[model samples]
Target: MSGPRIDPSLYRERDVVPIRRALLSVSDKTGLLELGRALADAGVEIVSTGSTAAQLLEAGVPVTEVAAVTGFPESLDGRVKTLHPSVHGGLLADLRLEDHERQLDDLGIRPFELAIVNLYPFAQTVAAGAPAGEVIEQIDIGGPAMVRAAAKNHANVAIVVSPDGYGEIRDALASGGTTLEQRRRLAAAAFAHTAAYDRQVADWMAGETGQADRVLRVEATLSAPLRYGENSHQRAALYTFAEGRGIAQAEQLSGKEMSYNNYVDADAAVRAAYDFERPAVAIIKHANPCGIAVASAKAVDPIASAHIRAHECDPVSAFGGVIAANRTVTLGMAEQVADVFTEVLVAPDFEDDALAVLRRKKNLRILRLPADYRREIREFRQISGGVLLQTADSFDQGVNSAQSDSSAWRLVSGEEVDAATRADLEFAWRACRAVKSNAILLADAGASVGVGMGQVNRVDSCHLAVNRAGARAQGAVAASDAFFPFADGLDVLLQAGVRAVVQPGGSVRDDEVIEAARRAGVPMYFTGERHFYH
Candidate 1:
């Protein structure tokens, strides 16, 4: 037995009466009181323990406390309440097996037909960074016991783990009783519920005790089933892990079905938009920022700005891209967005007038993410056989710790860079490391003037970056996503009159490349972080 089996055959026999009691206990009492009332009304006794019993009594439902049903008083801070044979026998007894039936009859044991349970919110508690005592208290004990017992004997009993299943339970009872299929589904829910809780506990203990070698184990629940996966041929779903809520859980204001890529890049773009304090637009293509601009939304609000600024960032790449903003969209924003094409737009809000204009483009997708969207991020990546999960890659770029101050190399030989200029250079470097392979970025002031990505070679990227600038590349600082790897890229920038360069200098022929920069009298600095996207 690999723990507990949840096979369909295990629940094949559902005709038995169960003398069959239904045990109910849950911390999330969303539908519990109603379920308790229904079970009791059906002449199926309701056995509960501690708080559940108190809640049932308060709700005017007649519930037999475990102590009353088992003829044993609660003990040891109530830990010993439901572990007795009176409870287990009812849960574990096999009604169909003759010898077991005879033994149960002789021993005066009555089997339970249903176990309605929802575990303590251990995941939420741990995620809240709760104190040790409180976290320990939240770990469920008897609930898992009853659920396992019921699930183990699913052929005789039905288990309901989610409050959402309360309706199905009533419908089943109304139509005589639950079918074997229903029992199996409930069993699977019971098992999955317990497993997720257990992983949370294990992860908590590992982190709390400072276990360096321990790996973080995670389990998240499916909040919604996606229409399809990366392709329409595959099935997909969205699993939530941000303390049970996040932008992923945000309601859609207006949109068609969000495709797999839309959700992936929309989340990425939204988080990136919140990185800076200033009002900005982040246009993301294929999960990477293609154009990021700090601009006035034509007016004060983002929706209006979208009208005027949406396509202004980069009209071509903005097509089918995802847009995110930290501020509300204004009418000017709406007008800006109205001109260009995009697949999705997300923000803290959209003004009524701006939204009205946006709605004209009926097929465009829009989502109002939670007000506190940046608090936590659950990043996920696909693997061949499983998945790789982590906290969203940390957004802190350590802007303060820059190599600009030191004379590691010369930016302008004798011309000392001022504090303001150094800040610009540092910010440009961050934008550089964030771009795609063969990537080159031209930064003037705080915004990108030109960006070249996914080029064949470093020289090609340099030409494309400067060419995109048209006339702006002159005197603009340039940054590359990786080491030059050769001097041809540098020669092209010198020809374009780019004054400064930033890149990761880790090539075997780095000295040669550095010598080339020295010859061109152009200052080139190396950022250790190499960003590569495939």
Candidate 2:
């Protein structure tokens, strides 16, 4: 992870000795019986732990208990099982070093040629929300120690850390055992396993305490080496964060590789969908929302507008947009968007019926993220020799926690909103809050009619919204991710006939903007926080 440490040149032509003696201990019993039997059949002696030995015996696999090999039974609540010199000597002895061999012979210690081990389920238990006591109980001390020792002597000892390696183990044994190259690769895997395991433990503790010093998990996926970064001559590669929960983790369905901007905006659209209660879709272009709509949970083609609302917002810029949905994607929806020159369709899952239709558009990017997944994307961007690393606002806890506090976006209209209108306002607020900064949104009932985002200034964004809404901007509810910087921004809204406005009321010129709204006779509400995505 810290880049490759060992040089590839050093591993070439390496000599390896077959493993004739191995120490095997694992709390996870998966494939243990088969592995022990295979090693025994290959003429390798097996040293195991308490229940592991019992299980191997029951399975008719020849094995020696750790006590038999180390002359030390597990003590101190099973902590002292493999800490003795006998166990350590077997793992650490260098077969090629005469001094090490002489010392081992003088002490009558056996040099183990292989160590097969997998640690206790620390990450799995922690992830299951176990109590700290149980999690601590699952941490393996002796297992990691043996793994490290065996990997250190990988020059002579082969270390296996994963059950998936059983096939390679058998192959090695059948093919006159493993060569040194295989041992090195196995050792690399062993160390990576331990490193990942340790990082997991550290991250779980960090998350429990709300500590940020050590990342809960590093977010990274490798990208191909580029001919050049920024400039065509610079070397560059792309990477995706491997952590966080969300649709981003879905296996690739099909399409060209995602570009840097595609991923950034797709993340925005998906996170926005998580905020809405009902099924919703947001079509994003260039990191900003272009078309957004919501409907009944059972509504088909949720983004499709009714005849009256079809002309409410311009769909010209909606071309090549990334659309994300909260519920399963269906055929009706696929057909509607399939006509548009869309780039990607991301959803919780895609129905086979929908997939059957969407696949014909071979170039359309399709992604299926996990249901109820949350992604907190964080990464670095560089400009002019300066690098910036920032945490991405991928999920809104405020949106998710609205039952206890819709305090973030309170509608304060002079004309009281009836229940139906209030519900629509909340829906509109949720949809609008997810657009990019310098944003303005216009919605009729529960569906968006106009959206403008990421402008150089809020007033220009207002123009973009009003222009897009055209005549339909009249009498539509308006929402802003941030408050107007001055009265002129609202003047643009009033000229466009916006009836109601929602904004995070924290601008220094709020009084000027409010006075303009009050004069325009437009009701305005203030939600105390800005939902800005940059």
lDDT of candidates 1 onward, in order: 0.73, 0.74
Q: Which one is best on lDDT?
A: 2
lDDT of 1 by residue, 404-520 (tens): 322453342324456555555655665554456778887765566677888879898888788777777888777887888888887888788877777777898788888887887
Q: For model 1, what is the C-alpha lDDT against the true structure? A: 0.73
RMSD after Cα superposition, model 1: 4.5
| TM-score of each candidate structure, all chains considered together | 0.82, 0.85
Which residue ranges in model 1 land beyond 4 Å of their true spot?
A: 1-20, 41-43, 58-60, 97-101, 124-139, 170-176, 205-218, 222-238, 242-247, 296-310, 375-394, 397-414, 417-427, 504-530
**How many residue pairs in model 2 have overlapping backbones?**
7
Model 2 residue pairs with clashes: 219-241, 220-241, 220-242, 228-234, 229-234, 245-374, 247-369
